[model samples]
Target: MGELGEVPNQLQSFRVQDAKCYCCNHSHIHPHSGESLPCDRQLVYETFKKWWSAGAEEGSEQHLERFNTLVRQRVAPKVARGLGIALPFHYVVYMAVFCMVPWLSDFIALWAETRDHRAAVSMWSLRHFIAWGIVGVALLFALRMCVWLWKLGSRIEKRLDSRWCAVFIVAPLSFFGVCALWLPIGISLAATPEDNPLPVFLFIAAIAITALVWRAPKWQEPLPSKQPSPHVFQRKEDNATFSI
Candidate 1:
């Protein structure tokens, strides 16, 4: 039999491969109080495997939990910074944009009202400003799409437990209280009645897509099935024939 005592080392076994967080300079130290994650789900899985291999010794349970927490604390942050320009971080940027949306609309409305010379201006000038606004929106959307593709490339789709996936769907927007999950639905409903509902519809669609992504059922590998040996089958058949 294989040596049953070759237990895993708690200090070194299940953790992130990297020395420190990609964002934070301190890898060895915790990020907030300094630490948990990225060494995350994998750590949990590896620990389970170790425990199974160790003959499920109950004493090692504490060691598994302790090491898991210690390693995760090293990667975790005190507060969500939403720093990366990539998929996970960009969700915050979208929230920031959502908060600004009303403000931007007000500014535009005030600008239109204050323009006492609108009646005197040519349609050509008005078209130019409208064109610029469209271009800006388009560019913002393009950037978001590229980052989203990069996020998918991170293979987070397979590892749905990634920090950016589940909670982030609601966390960032929670700042405005009602804006959490309600904001997207509200935007779509409010804008759908308007003449130009394209952007709001698009946002709503994006939220739906992300919803499917994060909430999608997690699939675990099925256990291998065992088959009886050919000799066992042959003996059974022989016994059955004789009995009959």
Candidate 2:
């Protein structure tokens, strides 16, 4: 037979060729028969040689450069984009709107109170102003936490774990919904103290919406099928398949 060690290196060379085209980045090419892939063997050698010369073998600068390039070229860009997008940055903008929601509530209440009375008592306006100022401050703090969450998310994403998906996306959305309902109810209750039915009804609706949104996805996922029985594979003496 032919020389022994030539087989493995030949196989590795084929492996490089079977990979998608480095220049055109296409995946349509077919590998040659009895080979892992079909391409110029010299080019495959050159690619690795360049990386080696660049310092991929030792604790050197070129090693990291080659590795980073390989990942950036092969790894999906959408995943990187998702990690980079920092959803918290966007939600903080939304939370800015959310925090202001209460002040809008206060403004509406003030407008209604002032419509009939030109000389309303200073106490009423002062109380609403203080309430709104507190809401604004709380929202600013929430916004800061949101910025922190985004930075944290970026850190988690770099680790390349599943928790990044849950914390960065799911947790923030849930918090937003919770705050949406609770903030309105708390402010309404605080501002009126007892006799308003309208805000209470609104609060209940917000809460119901939050609950539905949180749990609705559980029903949408499909269940896995049962595993196959063990006796399905039976070895045949006469018709055995062999790997060469």
Candidate 3:
């Protein structure tokens, strides 16, 4: 029988050999090619071991919750910052382009109002300047909203009972859903009977494609139990040993 507070040799060996990334559970070695990839397993395992030893029960919900909280405190901000930096680029490229579709007719009308060649040229340039300005402002607001949502997610994660920590994921989906509905309606309202319906179709297709293609940030859940069985940590009265 093992001494109190000592992990069994079998369990310790299993943990050491488990190559799955402790954070995301992504395997470090390619199954087919046998190539090794880098992951957060080293740091995560060290943290896990530290907390696991401190825990009153090896696999209890309270123990897991505390471990998750510690991980989030260390990791969530980095994830949030990464999303904040990366997502805005997608929003500027995809959302901004589709969003400007409704105003296309208005821009053309602004050009047509001045038939004089020089005047039309100046008017067209002015229209572009105004349009781009609006887009820039909108993009700023969108980026700010992303920041706000990440902060909100952090707050939600801090709550003892809350488990929803993917506000960044929700934001893009919500944005796309709104655009999917709004763009078609806007086109219908702004366009005449003779105007091409292609923009409407294109807008819907673009929203669908972006939603599918966009790789949103994923929050890693608490690592699953590595213990071979519940009995690994169960107190044994006859042997007077507590193995983990």
In terms of TM-score, the best-performing candidate is: 3
Tell me the tens digit of each residue's lDDT in model 2 across 1-244. 0122123223222222223342222222433333243334335545666765644455333432343344434442333333333234456557666857755775667757674432334444544554454444445444444544555554455556666474767467647844765577566757674334545465446535644533332211122112212222222222211211
Q: Candidate 1: misplaced stretches above 4 Å?
A: 1-13, 16-68, 73-123, 153-244
Model with the higher lDDT, candidate 2 or 3: 3
Span of 10 residues, lowest total lDDT, candidate 1: 235-244
Error of 1 at 169 (Å): 25
What TM-score quantifies how close candidate 3 is to the native fold?
Answer: 0.29
Assess the local accuracy of residue 244 in candidate 3 as a C-alpha lDDT between 0 and 100.
Answer: 20
Reference-based lDDT, residue 52, model 3: 64
Provide the overall lDDT of each model, using Cα atoms, as 2-decimal numbers.
Answer: 0.38, 0.43, 0.45
Clashes of 2: 0
Question: lDDT (0-100) at residue 126 of candidate 3?
Answer: 48
| Per-model TM-score versus the true fold | 0.25, 0.28, 0.29
Model 3 collision count: 0
TM-score of 2: 0.28
